[model samples]
Target: MLIRSSTPEALRQNNSLSVLSALRRQGALAHTDLCAQTGLASATVSAITAILERDGVIERLEQKPAGGRGRPRVLFQPKRDCGYLAAVRISSDQVQYSLVDYAGRLIDRFEEPRLGGDGATQAFGQSFLAALARLAERSRLARDQVLAISISSKGIVDPGAARLVWSPVFGGAALDFSALLGAVWPARVLLANESLLVAQAIAAQREGQGHIPAIAALSLGHSIGLGLARRDRHGEWEVSAPNFGHMQHVAGGSLCRCGSQGCVEAYAGFYAVLRTAFQVPPQTIPAKFVPIAEIDKIAAQARAGHRMAIYAFRQAGQSLGAGLARMMSLFGSMPVAVTGPGLRFFGLMQEGLLEAFAETHEGRLNGVPLILPMTGEDELVFEGHVTRALAEMDVMLATGQGGGAP
Candidate 1:
């Protein structure tokens, strides 16, 4: 376990954060509401909110009571223009950029095609940086106004410096995200795995609804992604995106994009399902992307009793289920929120998935974990961006490291 000593300055900042966190979670909470939610004294809440309002970080609203019965209730919310944030979500073929305000509202967004897609044999930093620059210009936001830039990608990322350590498309090459933007912009940089954001969104959504259970988010697409979200000792969401796709599944069995054999992705990825459906050799290289229409046609065949197609989905399901069982054994059982483009084929994968999972020792002993199929991966990802990016902004302002000379 890790521990750190708190100083006077840290304690003061934490008190401010507690007030801001209450407003964020409860949405325009009143002075008394902040006190209740944050467990802070009414005096402390008043002092913090006054400081926040004076610094232009938040604004108070006057709400009239129903039927004009009593005095208006005062509420506080983050100022819409306290600062700005840019959230970039990188996918196989495209990059999406969204400009968000301090209140975590989307102001503008656009997408641009990635240069190399999955064959990332060259640097994309030039185009990527250009896009970000364009985003700020388009939004008419100045350097200091942009408090933070949060990015997500489908690869291993460095949590602190926001580096893309290793990507399936780029192989061993890494992308220094923080440096790429540091010289051009003053905003703090944050990076997270794509699925990690998914988990964060789920966890944020579950807050205040009683206890938030530990859960795993499993994304099925061109690659398999897994993220775990649990509450920390302080009751904050702690999230991680493990390289679940590349974890070993069968010894020396099938080829993976990472040049590894018997990886879970080699069996459960979209290309793997396509390969098995077509009876392709295990040694054959997987395609970078398979059209959903093609997968749908195969699913149609599977539903029509096509032996190979049925077997293909079954193989993918078994691989995913087996991997999930091992995860449960190691991390203890938890609900799995399954999402991604691959969910369209869940109907075909359900039977084999459950069957294979039930066969595992962990599954048999503790029973299979609840598996929920969900949609809107893209929306959830952006929600995650807002939840995390705003929290960071709150701390920056509380620490006097944010915009408007806070």
Candidate 2:
């Protein structure tokens, strides 16, 4: 509700962003379609597009008539070589790096195994910077040519300062990305929670299809992560990733890696399901990794009516549902998209998950928002990183090119 109208400069930014957003969503729009998409006048679109073209940020595509008659229709699209972006996704076992062009096309990508956390913070930072250099060099681009670097990880991220505050891998060793990238490149740095990127990508996709009130993207895997994304009145996306995994579920219950007891991750995470399936003592240190094969076995057993496996999956679902219900109670009702590797086993947990939701007062009032199982978390996550980074880059280029300000 604190959201306010854009001021003079902000209005200009909105105008530029609307044009860029239209091109990004609909792809290579003619001036007429561009006006309709951005809800701007033809003159405004022409002015902005002209500035964009003059600054080499966009190019005009000519469509020849079928019979070579009359005039050719012209279209505007982002110039692929105008800028570049890098996306780094840090996971528990490995780090993935992808280079994308201004047109949101992938140029290059690779992965590096994450070394053991035997005092691995600074060392990992070194390797990551080197990887960035490799990413640029292999793509034949100078460091400065990469306009932005977007880093996503499964932990706490300070988007304002571009820092990794808390992560399952590094624990208390926080990494400030701006400081790390400051020396080698002049590009801006952005750090965001992995699930947050997923939400952004999904939000953009939904907006392209039509209006979406709000949605929550829940990641279930080695850990539980939650992200909420909504389009505000201004048609700008608002996204946030809460540390839903570590949030307390049952006080003084199972031990969590973050030194917390009774966190939601302690019950619903993959490790939690494994622990429950094996009836491991709640106080034991959680496993760093649980192979999906083991979970598959457990799921198979649960499907065969194995008592312990059934109970384990049911427990995970109920705990997850309770935490989500609490979230819905705080926020308004919204559809939930369950993503990540955990979707493979959702069939085992849907019953208990729904039952627990139905028990909540919020669920009773709202009638349990739609719970959809979404596959390909990786695709959405990468798409999100590019979408966010490129959007910011668009603002930078458009303003620098004299397109934002009147």
lDDT of each: 0.87, 0.87
The TM-score of predicted model 2 comes to: 0.94
lDDT of 1 at 35: 88
TM-score of 1: 0.96
* TM-score of every candidate relative to the true structure: 0.96, 0.94
| Global Cα lDDT for candidate 2 | 0.87
- Which whole-number lDDT from 0 to 100 does residue 304 have in model 2? 93
How big is the positional error of residue 311 in model 2, measured in Å on the Cα after superposition? 0.6
User: Model 1, 203-290: lDDT tens per residue?
Assistant: 8877758896588999998899998998888776789988899999999989997888999999988899999999999979888778
Writing each residue's lDDT as its tens digit, candidate 2 over 231-273 gives: 7877678999988999899999999978899999999888999
Q: Every model's Cα RMSD, please?
A: 2.0, 2.9
Clashes of each: 0, 0
lDDT of 2 at 72: 96
